[model samples]
Target: MHQNPSMADIKVIIPAFNEGDSITKVIEEVPDFVSEIIVVNNNSTDDTFEKAKKAGATVLTETRKGYGHACLCGLHYIDKRSKTPDIVVFIDGDYSDYPEDMEKVVAPILNENIDFVVGARKKELREPGAMTPQQVFGNWLATFLMRLFFAAKYTDLGPFRAIKYKKLKELQMEDKTYGWTVEMQLKALRKKLTYKEVPVRYKKRIGVSKVSGTVKGTIFAGVKILGWIFKYSIR
Candidate 1:
């Protein structure tokens, strides 16, 4: 890895699953201020790895095929590296997030020395019909319960978030399925980590979504996320 003298250092970790169509574009859209980009290919059936490599992102393959599994594999790679990162930014590979605003997401942690940052999305920011009714209701119900249980404030369980690498590791993130984002948020609150929210834009993705697409998928994902939130919030 090359060093930047300008002092703007960050590592972007993208977990991709069958996102070959837009992964390359997303990689290209990421701000160059980021020192490193690690893309974890979560058992993609397409050419996600090839496209990411073509876009100059360091790529690794995670055969287990879950969002949390892919992220954990990437984190393990980072942990094993000689030079660790100052911050770790987790973004989806589907290009729903505005890659340019990555600076905004990482700035609070970088400047104020905050421990973690979540990219919150307002209703207007979301693509029309981007979130299913179940998703919206699930977020509200889960977040309400979280606040009630742990007295912690949370706006969105967005996947587009960043955290200090050290503090992130200390949380011992263990979610291996669809509940990854919520698990991180609940654990961070329980651990009393300094976290902030930055409003971000969301767009329609290039391909189909695994969750929020089918009735079963939506219910299962919402149940898993809510279950994880309650499990940690009570602890």
Candidate 2:
């Protein structure tokens, strides 16, 4: 087992919407050395907030109802704190990602001082049906555009990512919906932040994905992602 680095101040932010069933498992699996786990309950009608709090997470509520909105809320919460963490990690509330591999996701930043690290869900590491066909095609299309436009090496806009808190703030992230992940990557490229990808395991999530499972959600997400890519490409 790789030991957690004691010196690094790491905080994890989870944006959840009606993820009560899988929130606790996600929190419980987080490595112990993490300084804090902040679960942003994104207007979940269910008991997501309660379950996360019960699991010992510092839960916050974001009534705005967007993935970026919830993540921004967590960032605001951290910004208000007297002691800022060295690194911030963003992961899903669903149990699709292996929380235990957080150590690996943050390793490049912790050891090599990389500005950002993305936990790439490589095909070999992902379980069957873990990603929908739309999700797969979307990732491929987005990354291909990124490579063509910016000479970026990003393969997946995976949410399980880590970045230095200072660099993250420097990016001035403003996406409030499906474009959040790609916006970060594009901005990181624009700012010339050193980044690395670490292949990680992925499993089927406990519940249906709010974004990829529904037709409307998938279409909106695709449009938003493509919009960001084109907007940045022209700049």
Q: What is the C-alpha lDDT of each candidate?
A: 0.86, 0.95
Q: Superposing all C-alpha atoms, what RMSD in Å does each candidate have to the true structure?
A: 3.0, 1.6
What shift in Å separates residue 40 of candidate 2 from its native position after superposition? 0.1
Candidate with the greatest lDDT versus the true structure:
2
Where is model 1 more than 4 Å wrong at Cα?
A: 1-8
**TM-score winner among the candidates?**
2
For residues 130-171, what per-residue lDDT tens digits would candidate 2 score against the true structure?
Answer: 999999999999999999999999999999999999999999
Candidate 1 residue-wise lDDT at 5: 19
lDDT of 1 by residue, 160-227 (tens): 99998989998998888899998888889878999898999998777878888778778788889978
Q: For every model shown, what is its TM-score relative to the native structure?
A: 0.94, 0.98
Clashes of each: 0, 0
Q: Which stretches of candidate 2 lie over 4 Å from their true place?
A: 1-4
